[model samples]
Target: MSILKLGALRGQLEIKEFLRQRESVVFTLAFPVILLFIFGSVFKNTIAPGVTFSQYFVAGMVASGLVNTGFQQLAIAIPMSRDLGTLKRLRGTPMSPISYFIGKAIVVTASMLFQVALLLGFGALLFGLHLPTSGILWLRFTWLILLGSACSTVLGIAFSSVPKSGRGASAVVSPIVIVLQFLSGVFFVFSDLPKWMQDIAALFPLKWLTQGMRSVFLPSDFAMKEAAHSWELGKTALILVIWLIIGTLLSIRTFKWSEE
Candidate 1:
């Protein structure tokens, strides 16, 4: 069979496995929604003149959902597979290592997309979140989601190189995701964060992804709440692209097919 065909098959199996892990899948997708209801309900008042906290938070929740599927899941699964001899066994098969990671990435992207849809649908249905009305805005949102997913997935595989065993994956990756979420304005308003904290968070992809998503869903006038008092679309795309390149390079350099 062609490598592409083999990779596609592997990705299909990955999706099946994801479905089998019903509890994990449910938690991964539902955590953001739960937070949306909790925080969005408590901060029901407007964060800006016309935008309620729920409306303002929809983008961040979407970003968080992508991160959970892209980074957290891969970070745990990849290292666990390595320590469990799954990777070593696969290495002995006809499948190339690239095919393995490709399968992993495809599954991550698909899962993230499902999560994104859920968040947006729930937000619009229950929280009065306004989706992008213009075709151009939707186009912007599409490319941003694709770029953000690729960057986050690659970063996750790169990060998996840090943990030597499945047992340690959470220890190595959880703090990073948690810190990024907090600092990237996932649970708070970016404009309200300290300048130094904003500067630090700006160095990561989550902040830019969240900001890019906000630019798509929020009203144009809402740019006033952003750090630049604008959407910064160009900067957001550029930063995520740069991270994609960097993360791809890092994963190539560090990805392992077997425990080391």
Candidate 2:
């Protein structure tokens, strides 16, 4: 079979396997909505004069959902596969590692996109969130989500090397994800965060991901509430692209077929 077709088949299998794993599905898909319900209601008051807290919060939650599925899920799954000898067996097969990685990436991208849509729908139907009206904004949003998800997935694959066993995957990866979530303004305003914390967050993709989504979904004037008082699209794109490149290289260099 052609490489393209092979990859698609592998990816389809991966997605199916992901769906069948009830624990993963629950954590990846349901956890974000729970966060939204708990925090969104508490912060139901408005951010700006016109923008309600739910409106402001949805963007960050969407970004968080992307990372949750794209990064957290993959990080754990990859290591668990390694511990289970799945990666070792795959390596012995005719299928190349590239195809397997591509399959994993496809699964992450699909899950994250679905998660983002559900969050947006909930925000819109229940909280009255407004989506971008302009086609250009939608285009930008599409590419940003694609790039952000890709970067996060690649980072997850790379970080999988850090955890030695399936049991330790959550312990190793969850703290980093949770810390980034808090620091990236996922639950709070970026500008209101301390200056040092803001600086640290700028070095990571989650902050930019949240900010980029905010640029798409929130009012343009809400940019004033951002750290630099603007969307900084160029910076956001550049940072994510850089991470993607670095992550791809790292994952390739460090990847192992087995736990030996």
| TM-score per model over all chains | 0.97, 0.98
lDDT per residue as tens, model 1, 25-100: 8888788888888887888888787788788788998888778898888998889988989888998888877777
Question: What are the clashing pairs of model 1?
Answer: none
Q: Which ten residues in a row are the worst by lDDT in model 1? A: 96-105
Best-fitting candidate, measured by lDDT?
2
Highest TM-score model number: 2
How far out, in Å, is residue 198 in model 2?
0.1
Residue lDDT tens for model 2, 1-260: 76677888899999999899888788788788878777777887887878887887899998888788888988888899899898999999899778888898899888888888888888888887998999988998999989988998899899989898989999989999999999998888778899999999999999999999999998888898888989999999999999999999999999878988
